[model samples]
Target: MAKLISLFFGNAFILAYALDESTNQVEAINLKDISLPITLDSLQTKETIYPIPAMICFDDRIFYGQEVRTHKKFFSPHTFLYMKQYIAKNQHLPRIIGDQEISNFQAAEILMISIIHRIEEIYGAENISMYVFPVPPKGFEIFAQWIEKFCFRIGLVSFKIVDGGVCSLLAYGLGHELGTNFMYINFGPMCLDLYILKVEESSNEPRLRSVLLGGLNKNYGSIDIHKSLRDELIDYNITVRKAAEIVHHLINNQTFEEEINGQQLHFSRTQLHELLNRKGYGQELKNILADLIDLASGIGVTYESVQYVLCAGSSLQVPYYRNILKDFFGYKLLYNKAHNCPAARWSGIPSASGQWQYHQGQLRAPQPDSKGRRL
Candidate 1:
């Protein structure tokens, strides 16, 4: 039997998951480590090339993740291509890649094609029957259309685009429990999306109705937090790359003490918390939750009505955001112990729902409200 593949295109990473026939278990793959080569005639130079640590080369032209960061000449143009705002505003921007100037949309298309090809290589193309993409709630229609077009271009005939919030609920096996309201929050690297959904029995099958959908400002995300931290260290002549490392350490509750440009620097969890507060990261989350609560209240869904708050994405791993969520939801927040990274929990959706076969065609497209927000 052909397998079903589910993909979640995140701002900073692409996650692909499918059921393994041999083991009868779900396998999740992160596509970031896989690099596609850009063939260029200039790469065939006579100069001897030295191998860099943690670098993989293809056709002696393109390099892998770490190498691209190390080599100033090589660039990764599709770093945050999946970001909604980035795609909307800069889709036409030209990205120079090895003497080729590719538009942002073209780059995105190439990246998608590469992802599909990689998936096919892992699980033979002939053995995959369908592709399912779970899109964010706020811009579901636009994201669906864009992703559907790419699917068509890639010649995928059987595919589905479902609400990401609903998928998260199903991933947790909450789809069949009727009359319960669930809040799904995805704290991605680039942005945060929250959705309130009520499970109902529709014609003997579970149905998820959208109660409220909202997101933080597009500029509010873990990456933005990293940028803020980086800016704070700019006076010390800290490079962007080093700042990212420092931020990572701080987020993981590890103290970072280093000397840059002969100046000593130290970062601790307490310092990180203070920085987050000063930058209004916690306040922004609180404000968005308040707004979402107000909207949900208008629809008869109160804070007390929400049973479980399912949190996903790597950002939620950060203590600052996790603490904010804990303060807001308290005991209602749910975490997966089996999978430390909540975002990876999404990969289990396909396997959990048995490939979403029974629930096919039941998910309703979100309708826009007076302010054009999905409700």
Candidate 2:
């Protein structure tokens, strides 16, 4: 069945989901279709409003869109939620790496509410029937009561909030036609979730059966690689930290050019593209690759059942990162596709990092977070 999928980002949330067969895919909906706006009282409401039609899918489980939009000014996308403590020290640099540590309760409730609101906006509340398949982080049971309370309030009285990685497996399973025996890895800013999914095709509709999922806390993300590259430059007194910061910002959007310190330093995306294409930075690129290899080795899945790798997020778009993985793992191993969104399309795939991601303690980062804080 065709469904209206909406992607939402704002506040501290990120959520996405597909509508079921019972729901109609409306290009437009009636104003009288919605219940009173969530924020407004029934007594104060005059009529209903319709929401937009958009497909929703998520890898990180936290709701994006409205929650992120509402809190955008304060939110830095690359930082890990659990590592907020490191934000203050690294805030000076254009790029800062930190893990976002949030209670599962907060993660689930806020995300559900945000998704419900976003769905209401697109299809109108009355017409929208959503099934939230939230990917639970490790130790999800701690948030059980919170999930129960959230379900009761959101009208998802009979919905499911499964593990985010498993949900991703479902999405990836459909996209890749993955059979019962493949594994799925979801690499995000805060953690990496790996799952061994067995699809039970015994029924007419394939179902995710007998899933083994786990979350790893090595926690090397896009910003960590950026910082590592910056440190490599600092060792030579090149001090391209500013440039590195701009590049990090550019990966997400092309607005960083306007924020350059001076016209001499004012580099556009085209110029940055050229910089990556130039021949002088081969060593720097190698250093970045070494870091990623180390990260994979530490994770113990470097040579595991990694048949197809999916790379996403702003980090993987960097030529420095892509070339290294391509050179070492071969062209097919790199998921840098021309037709893809470059960022979103590469989501959940493994790429490279610095010493922090390495296999052994011997290849540790030479210049640690000046403050010795590990990402």
Candidate 3:
């Protein structure tokens, strides 16, 4: 176990360097007068642990940073339009079996692969061996088959599918500094992941124990919410979609310094709360938010037996949501400040005890290290 942990951490460093180098390459190209240093620093700080160069699209706006940058540079506007069409045609259907459908997985994989292909074009496909961990909801077989077909279509010959919540658990286990019980909550599109973690019972030494998995209420992930918002505003409906989109745009674009309705609208942190607090739309918006909160609470109640919750996700970017969690779960509830993509390059070594052996074809017993350590 220790060896495996060490190997992963070592790889994390190498991946970090490669990602940093790619960001520098992008920084070399000057666009929008954005300085290389600022971009470099931003990328370095925001995505130190991500394994490869990828694009992260939240809502309609895209974030192109060092580790997870959008592929806006390579594709034309028409290309994006086609891509959106393909996504909608294939993915926008509701599933009868599980929380998601085949189309849903395909859409996500296509987007992720698009980012991967963009990075490979820059860094050479020979060096890019990627893995994806898509969180699975109840009744995952249907979606799994869909993902398998999508992987084949995308030419991803070698890949692995892990439960998204489990991947987060793997990261959290590896990231533990002290032997204290911890809880992880991953809020994604479709569902939320709740995991209860503690030290194992058998081992005298501290290590991650069995996980108790639960899910919170279901809704479209941040991406879905953002898209809904954009659609509503485009249609001039002051619905949940519009409110969500406005908040999403401001957070990602940061230059929320736009003039709308002949009034200068500075979408600072308080924009969501302020907008929701307004007269007519407030009630409806509050209801939507309340539904999301209820979902979270429902999931929390399933694990209500446990305390110490840590929230992580793109949606957590909203301050109001965090406040809601704190109020509902009490002060003991916390948020994860780690980069959103912790699974790809998570660090921290776990200690595993066993014998090691290296052979030409088969292995024997575990060998001792220089310090006479067996594992």
Q: How many residue pairs clash in each candidate?
A: 0, 54, 9
Question: Residue 103 error for model 2, in Å?
Answer: 8.6
Error of 1 at 169 (Å): 1.4
Q: How do these models rank on lDDT, best leading?
A: 1, 3, 2
Q: Candidate 3: list runs displaced more than 4 Å.
A: 1-116, 137-158, 173-184, 189-213, 220-255, 260-263, 277-307, 347-375
User: What local lDDT does model 1 show for residue 217?
Assistant: 30
Give the runs in model 2 whose Cα sits over 4 Å from its true position.
Answer: 1-115, 136-149, 157-183, 189-207, 213-215, 222-306, 310-375
What lDDT score goes with residue 11 in model 1?
A: 39
Tell me how far the alpha carbon of residue 157 in candidate 1 is from the true structure, in angstroms, after superposition.
Answer: 5.3
What is candidate 2's lDDT per residue for 81-198, written digit by digit as tens?
3123323343211221123222333334544465566666765655533333333334433333345455566545433333333334334333334443334333333233334333
Model 2 deviation from the true structure expressed as Cα RMSD, one decimal place: 16.7
Find the candidate with the highest lDDT and give its number. Answer: 1
Best by TM-score: 1
- Give me the displacement of residue 286 in model 1, in angstroms: 1.9
Predicted structure 3: clash tally = 9
